[model samples]
Target: MISSNTAQPMKDIYLPEPADVLKASPMTALEMFFEFRLASGRELGHMPGQFVEVSIPGIGEAPISISSSPTQKGSFQMVVRKVGNVSGAMHALSAGRQVGIRGPFGTHFPVDGEMKGKDILFICGGIGLVPVRSAINYVLDHRDDYGHVTILFGTKTPADRLFTDEMQRWASAKDVTFMETVDRGDDAWKGNVGVITTLIPKVRLDPARTVAVVCGPPIMYKFVILELDKVGLKADRMYVSLERHMKCGVGKCGHCQVNGLYACQDGAVFKYSDIASVREAI
Candidate 1:
């Protein structure tokens, strides 16, 4: 047998594509919207709820969801919250800056398939809106394909609200029923003041035909699920984006493992019935 001098080629799982920051705009005190385009001329081609690992040379990398819909071609966008070392460094970069993007990784929202022609309900808490916005925009962009759409968004305070401009557009649109709430009220807030769960009760939908998508903090899930159930929504009908410390974005790190499932591989988005037995999932 000939001695093999050649080693098997390793997949570039961690290698990143050069991306230029086309624009960056501050959405709130801690969060900002960043737009990027690949220098290699390839599109990110990401679906709703899918994420990419943003890598900064010598700084580090972090998993962030694509906030822009695939329908918007030529580029992709991510809403970054300046919560860590990588993110804080990312925030410091201005437009025309360069960074590395590892993937449009993990599972994506089943928007084009199962969600077609069905009434859609979006329940987002604070930064949860980032990923869910992709689905919301896809539905809005393809309005004829889906049924009634409703959006319920909640934030910690009025000042913490993200995408105010987009919210205004959705609120005024005839296609979607929009409601916003805050956990606490301020002197300036004019809309509802309560947990996001409270907003779900006011809306009406046929549970059989409606698919609910939710993303938020740990405590938010149980309460939201409880309220959705009261309206005849079942676990199987609900899809959620589970937040985890997904490092590899490819299930290699095992950091985002929830029982037998890995959030980075099996999902960041999972049907409620699928993960009902996963104690750590909720």
Candidate 2:
């Protein structure tokens, strides 16, 4: 027998750790913000642009992106949209409620690596802002490590906006540029009114030194890429999140596979150039 005594037991990837809901609040009519702390009292230690699998005992499980940066220690945060069984169950939860958490799985943005010392342009649309917020806050926290920062956000209407207070803070930052837009304007709306792409042309950046991070609905990708191109952002210099395609937090299930790559395994975040040839990726 080949060193059977020295063999280690395989770890179960599907096993979930118990976590407590420290807080839950409404961000919009459809989304709820949740803060969770592991029962073991350790940090989630998730990277920006990564995700976790949230499980409710009887309702099933769902993959939710981590909305808080790792710099925010002790607990982690998620913005869950009440669109399905698990998320709907999560919205009904309150502080003290317990849930299961599987991972801080998948690849993340290059905040500490290639992105350092480079200008960053963040483009977020609708609920897509949830995942991108992690990276955004990380960049803001270490503002000195990066170059100029520009953040652009768009939603269907003013009523659909999330993190309003944070957006205002970002706008007020001395070195940051923040702009928001809506598809349609209302009586209460006083800002730009158009798709997110329209805001792209208004900003000035040195494309050679700038890296763009984009996340949004599937339909938004095609149009936004065109806009980024017009602004001279190269495909290799851009990254995008495809969190919507993630089903199983692990790659065992084929649900999240885009061509031959698994979104949950290979990435929910990918360099635009890496997946440009993968037909189903975008």
Candidate 3:
């Protein structure tokens, strides 16, 4: 039997390729974020749902999801939660701070020819919306290139919501549908109050043709997937992003291993089918 915890050593890990910090700012006290513009002015050439590794000297690096869409040129943004050593140092940084970066890694959502003319459903939870934001924005920017779009987002509470300004605009867009929920409601919160799964039932979707992308804390995956399946969306039609402690941005690092597959290289973005057999992927 395969050892579920067998992992590679860090000495074998590969370093991330470098990029420049073009901009940085505070989204919240716990969140210090930045946008990196590749030196070549070339697109990261990534599909939605990929990530990059950002580093501050001496503090090390961590895998952060690319929160900006591939369709948006010039730069890509990553929002880091100030929770640990590396992230705390990142939060103390300022604009034009030089940092190490590598990637544009992981499999991406199938947004090209296959998704065209089909409805798309995005169900994001808390900070999970950060990664999903890329795809949502891409679809929105190229609105005419696809069919109906619905975004159902939920967070812990009103103050914890990310990208409020952009979310408001998305909700009001002529061609998009948006609704939000807070697990615990505050007096100022007028939106739905409950688990995000509760909002799934109200969504109008042709499950056979609709593509659903859901991301959140690992514990939230199972319940959300069950809700999507209840709507008749096939497991293969659903995609989810999995998070792991990653030391290397490339596959060489064993930190992100899920059995034989490396979350850094093989996933971070995966179809339900791709990881369905991988025991720890949920």
Cα-based lDDT for every prediction:
0.92, 0.92, 0.83
lDDT of 3 by residue, 1-282 (tens): 977876875552345545678777888767756888776567777778888777777888777899998878888888889888888888777766677766777877777755677788988988899989998998888888878899999988788888989998999998788989999998888889999999999998998778888889898899999898898988888888889987776777588898888887788878887787889899
Worst 10 residues of 2 by lDDT: 242-251
| Cα lDDT tens digits for candidate 1, 1-282 | 976868887888989889999999888999988999999989898989999999999998899999999999999998899999999999898899999998898888889788898999999999999999999999999999999999999999999999899999999988789999999989988989999999998998999999999999888999999999999998988999998898889878889989889998888999899998899999
TM-score of each: 0.96, 0.97, 0.90
Backbone N/Cα/C clashes per model = 0, 0, 0
Local distance difference test, candidate 2? 0.92
For model 2, how many clashes?
A: 0
- Displacement of the residue 99 alpha carbon in candidate 2, Å: 0.7
Q: What TM-score should be assigned to candidate 2?
A: 0.97
For model 1, name the residue pairs that clash: none
Candidate number achieving the greatest lDDT relative to the actual structure = 2
Q: Which regions of candidate 2 are displaced past 4 Å?
A: 1-7
Candidate 2: pairs in clash: none
Model 1 poorest ten-residue lDDT run: 2-11
